[model samples]
Every structure is written in structure tokens, then in C-alpha cells.
Target: MNMERRGFPVWSIVAIVLIILGAITAGLSIETVPEGSRGVVTKWGKVTGRTLGPGMNFLNPIGVDVISVNVRTRKFEQIEEAATKDQQDVQATVVVAYHPEPQRVGQIYTDHGLDYEAKLVTPGVTESIKVATAHYSAEQLVTQRAQASDEISKIITAKLAANGIIADSVNLINYQFSADYTKAIEDKVAAEQLAKTEEMRVRIVTAQAEQAVVAAKGEAEAIALMAKALADAPDVLKLKQIEMMREKWDGIMPRVVGADGMSLLMTTGE
Candidate 1:
């Protein structure tokens, strides 16, 4: 009697197992990189210096690993305290926007790894802020804030460039000082305003006094000139009196007493 075979041939079972293993190996060899991102490929925990762009890429699945690195711009914000040029303590809100150089991402990963922001970017930004803040006084930091931000950006740009990072922008959003310094600034401004008001009042009073003196001098000169004219001609006074009488006289003539005590009628011709 022929013995019933318990299962299929041994070769068939081995073929099925081989097929499943191949399918798993094929799946492991493929890697999909998303947009705005780059895959850093490594072999046996060693950097391969080969970057993969978006889409599927095939590589040896046995010892190769892929690390996704985002190439898009990223923001880093922190509040930093620094000393100003005038030895004043100040705090600033520092924001730095940066991104890794796409072509040099492999080198960046090799040097800085995944914690590049913490290791390189943060220290670079912090040091740049301190360096820039040292150039300006606390008051200038507030008044020339745009200038300060530009300086910080330039510093960070140079600092990060060595590490394969492109610093896009740097912003100094807010500034704070000690309470005593703030009060001192306020008091100084108030004093300046008060002084300006006093200066204006003094100028107005001086102008008024000068005008009064000019008027008095003009009146005195006129009186002196009239006295000289009268002394040169005594009959000028009598002419003046006659002119005044004519202005007040009616059409009728008036009777007056002459030096000899005789009554006489005074009349003026038209």
C-alpha cells in the first residue's frame, strides 16, 4: 500500500518560505522621502554621504538606514539676557529662522547629527546676540532696534555658515530692562520736556520786554524833537493853540477881553 503524503514536497515548502523572505527584503530596501525633506543614508551606522530626494529610493536593506532631514526653513525663538555696552542688563526676545543647506546635508548630519539645533544653532544664536548687544547701549537697543536686529542676523549668518546652516532672518521682538533703569529714563524724558517749556516761556517774556523798550524809546525821541522845534520858533505854540481852537469852534465868533481891558470880537477867515 502507498503511504499518504502528509504534506507537499519539501522543496515546495522551502520555495514558499523563500518567496516570503524576498517580499520582506524588497519592502525593506525601498524608502520614500517626503517633500521638503532629505534622507540621509547610512550603512552599518556609518554615514554614506548620499542624500535621497523626494520619492522612492532603493538601497541595500541589510545594513543601511535612512534619516529624514527637513530642508525647509525653521524658526527658533528664545529669550536671552545680555549685558549692554553701558553695563546695563537687558533681556531680549530673539528669533532666528534658518535651514540646512540641501546639498551639504550629509556633512551637516555627520558633524551635528539630529540635535543640530540645540548644539549648533542655539549656541550660535545666543553668542551672536551677546556680541551684537555689546555694541549698543541699553537705550540704543530700544531706539535703534532695527539696527540691532540686522547686526544680530549678520553675526548669526556668518556663525552658522561654517556649520552648513543658512540663517534666513533674525528678529528682536521685545526688550526689557530693570525697573530702576526704566524709571530713570522716564524721569529724564519728563525733565527734558519741562526744560523745553521753561525755555519757551523765557523767550516770549524777553520778546515782550524788548517791544516795550522800543515803544518807550520811540515816544521819548518824539517828545525831544517836538521840544527842539518849539524852542526854535516860539510862535509855533500859538499856531498850535489856534489850530486846536478852530477844530472846536462853531460858526459863531466869540467875544474876548484884550490886553487894554477893552471888549473885542475874535473871528477867523475861512
Candidate 2:
């Protein structure tokens, strides 16, 4: 009886073994969580509410999933145009610093989904900027730019934290005003500078005029004192005239012709 062995073929056994090895290989693979990251594990597309830290971790081969959340600081920027309190349009470039809370990673993912950037972050930043900017006039916003940024940061930090997100800081990168408004501000500043310059010029001229008047008065006073001294001693005039002639002639003798044509000799040296 050519009874073929009813046992399974050797090739079939080998195929079964290969399939089992493949399943084991897939299940034994390790997923790596990078530094500054938190891993979230989900089972059957539902979050398991468990967070894993950085390193290699094992998850279910077919039914479990692992997602990495960035725990390090992150930055987001947006350029937005909105109306100020005075109904003037302004363009503001804003930057936000934030990081996902590691403990709340699963909840954040579940609530905001994987696209939290579009769902939560963008809207939060937009609302924060709008609300804070709406409280200031365009002029004040321009002048007190730092204060406006601080206000926006505070509002965003508070609001975002309440929703399980941590914001490190918010910055107002730049602000742009309408061309007409910018020109108006520039004109006003130029006018103020010109007025200041004119005032400074007037002050300088007034000071110079006062100094000149004082100098003239001092000279007149000195002359009057000399005249009074000469009057107190009548001979002082003759002595002053002799001193003046000595200075002018440099110790030389002079010949004076009088009104009757008589010559007189004047000796300057003793």
C-alpha cells in the first residue's frame, strides 16, 4: 500500500515557522523616544492615559500605538492685522514660546488631536493678541510697544495654561502702521523737533544779549570810577597824561611847538 505519510509537508511546517517568527519580530521591535520627548501609548486608537519618557519602549504589535510629544521649548510665529481701540488698522508679527506639558500629553492629544498647532495654538495666539491690542490706541500702541507685548504675553500664558498648555513667553516681533499714519507721526515728530530747535536758538541769543549788556555796563562803571577818582584829585589828570605820554613815546624826548610858535622841550626820562 503506497500510503503517503499524512503528516504535514516539511515546506508547510517551515512556512508556519517563518510566519510565527515574523510576528514575534514585529512584536519585539522597540520604538525610540527622542530626548526632550514624552511618548503617549494608545490601544485600539484610544489613548491609554499613560505617558512614557525618553528611551526605547515596547508597544502592542498590532493594536497599540505610540506617539511622541515634544517636551522641549517650541516657538511659533504669526503675522496678523487687527484694529486698535481707535479703529486704526495695525499689522503685528507675534511669536509665541511654548511646550507641551508632559503629564498631560495624552489629554492634550485627545482633546486637541494631533494637529494642535492649527486647532489650539493658532487660535489661542490670535485671540490673545487681539484682546490685548484692542485695549490701546494706535499712538499708545506704537509708543508703549513693550507694554503691549507684555500684556499679550500675560494673557496668552494664562489662557493657554488653563487649557493644559504651558507658554514660556510671547513676543511682539514687529508692528506696522498704515503709510498715512506713519507719515503723520513722522510729521508731528519733525514739527516738535523744529520747535525745540527754535526755542534753543532763542535761548542762546537771549543769553548772548544779556552777556553783552552786562559787559557794556561793566565798562561804563569802570569809566565812571576812573572819572570820579580823577575829580577827587585834580593833579591826577596831569600825572595820567604824563604816564600816557611816557607809554606812547617809549622814554624819548619830545619837541612841542606852542601856539605862538615857541618850541618847548619835554624830557620823558628822569
Candidate 3:
């Protein structure tokens, strides 16, 4: 018996080639989105308005593309110079922390495209700062930097939300004013402190004067009371004089002069 062997048929070879090509296309069509990212699917340069979550995703192998969108928190920093309510120039670096809405990335890409930070977040932060700064004067902005940051964040959050972006936080990293303005503020604060010191000194002096007046009045009243007591009891004076004599007398007769200029003799009491 003789065994016959033949090479692979031409049709089978073509079929294998086609199958390899198909496998390659299929591999290319599947996308693996990393953590903290989402996908926006588009067909023929038009968004399908479908969003994909993290992990592996499959799509049609032909004419369909998936764009990866970073849903993680991002930051955009810009220096904005705006006028306060008092028409004072304020320059600050505004840092905005934001992320695309994971569920709305498709809408975000469709409305604002991939450069949404420049188109939306940056402008949103700038305008929000401008508007929020207008609500306060230059002095207020400096004194209430934290409050200004909060207000700007609120404004930016609302503004961006409508466009499918989430503004996490807004921070006024650095705030500045004109040198002359800062000097003026310092001088004004010094003057206010000086004025307060003067007022305190005046109050102290006034209190001292009042205390002195009360002390003098008290002394005068004491003197008046003594005089009244002495007048009401003239015998008290005689008793006091007697006590003085008793303290000073010796055991001998004494000579005294009367008010009428007459000499008188007095004997010490036994």
C-alpha cells in the first residue's frame, strides 16, 4: 500500500490569513482603560454619546474609536488680575482642582472636546474670580482670603457643573496688591492703633481724676463730721484736755495764767 500526502490547499491558506487579520483587528478594537479613567466612544469622528467605565471594553472593530478620559482630579493654575469693588487692582494665582464627570464624559467631549480645561475650567475660574472679587473691596480680599477662595470655588463649581465638569476646590494660592496700597494699609492700621492707645490713656486719666475727686470729697466729709461732733459736744473737748493734763502733770503745785491775764495757782489732784 502507498500513502499520498498533499500541501495545504490554497483556499485553506487564504482562510487562515483572513482569520489572522480578523484577530488583529479585534485585538485593536478592545480597549483597556486604566484606573481613574473613563472612555468616550466615537464613530467616524462623531461622538456616540456613550461613556465607558474603567477596565476592558469591547467595541466594533471597524470605524469605531474609544477615547480615554482622565476622570481623576486635575488642577489648572492661572494668574488673574481683576478689580475689586473699590476699584483696586488685585493679582492672584488661582488654582482650580477639577475632574470630568465620569458619567458625563461623553457629553463633555461632545460639547467641549478634549481641551476642556482651556475652554471651560480656565475661563470658568477666571470669570468666577472676577465676579467674586467684585463682591469685596481690596482690604476685604486680603483680610478674607479664605472667604474669597470659598466664594470663588462656589461660583466655579456652579459654572462648571452645567458643562459636565466637577470643580473640587478653588484656591487663591497667592494674593498681591500694589506696594503703595500695602504701605497705605500699614500706615492706616498704625494710625488706628495709635488712636486707640490715646483713647485708652484718656480714659485712664479720666478715671484717675474721678477717683481723686471722690477721695477729696471723702476727706472733706470726714473733716466736717469731726467738726460737727466737736461742736455738738463741747464737753468732749474739756475731757480731752483733762486727759492731756493728767498725762503731763507731776507731783507738785503748778502756777497758771488765766485768760484775763491774771496769775493763778493750781494744785495737782491727789
lDDT of each: 0.89, 0.85, 0.86
Q: Give the clash count for model 2.
A: 0
Clashing pairs in 1: none
Tens-digit lDDT string for candidate 2 (112-218): 87677787788888888789889998888877888998898899898888777799878888889989998887787789889999999999999999999999999
Candidate 1: C-alpha lDDT: 0.89
| Clashes found in each candidate (C-alpha, N, C closer than 3 A) | 0, 0, 0
Could you tell me the C-alpha RMSD of candidate 1 in Å?
7.5
Off by over 4 Å in 1: 1-29, 58-63, 142-146, 200-270
lDDT of 3 by residue, 12-58 (tens): 77889999998877646677888898888888989988888889887
- Each prediction's TM-score versus the true structure: 0.66, 0.70, 0.74
Q: Which 10 successive residues of model 1 have the least lDDT summed? A: 1-10
For model 3, the run of ten residues with the poorest summed lDDT: 1-10
> What ranking of all candidate models by TM-score puts the best one first?
3, 2, 1
Candidate numbers, best lDDT first, in rank order: 1, 3, 2
The C-alpha RMSD in Å for every predicted model, in order, reads: 7.5, 6.5, 6.7
Tens digit per residue, CA lDDT, model 1, 1-270: 122286577777788999999987875678899999999999999999899998899887888999999989999999998999999998889888899988988998998898889989999888888999999988777668788888888888999998899988877788899899978876876898899999999999999999999999999999999999999998999899899988997967789998999989987585
Where in model 2 is the C-alpha error above 4 Å?
1-31, 34-36, 43-48, 58-64, 72-75, 161-171, 250-270
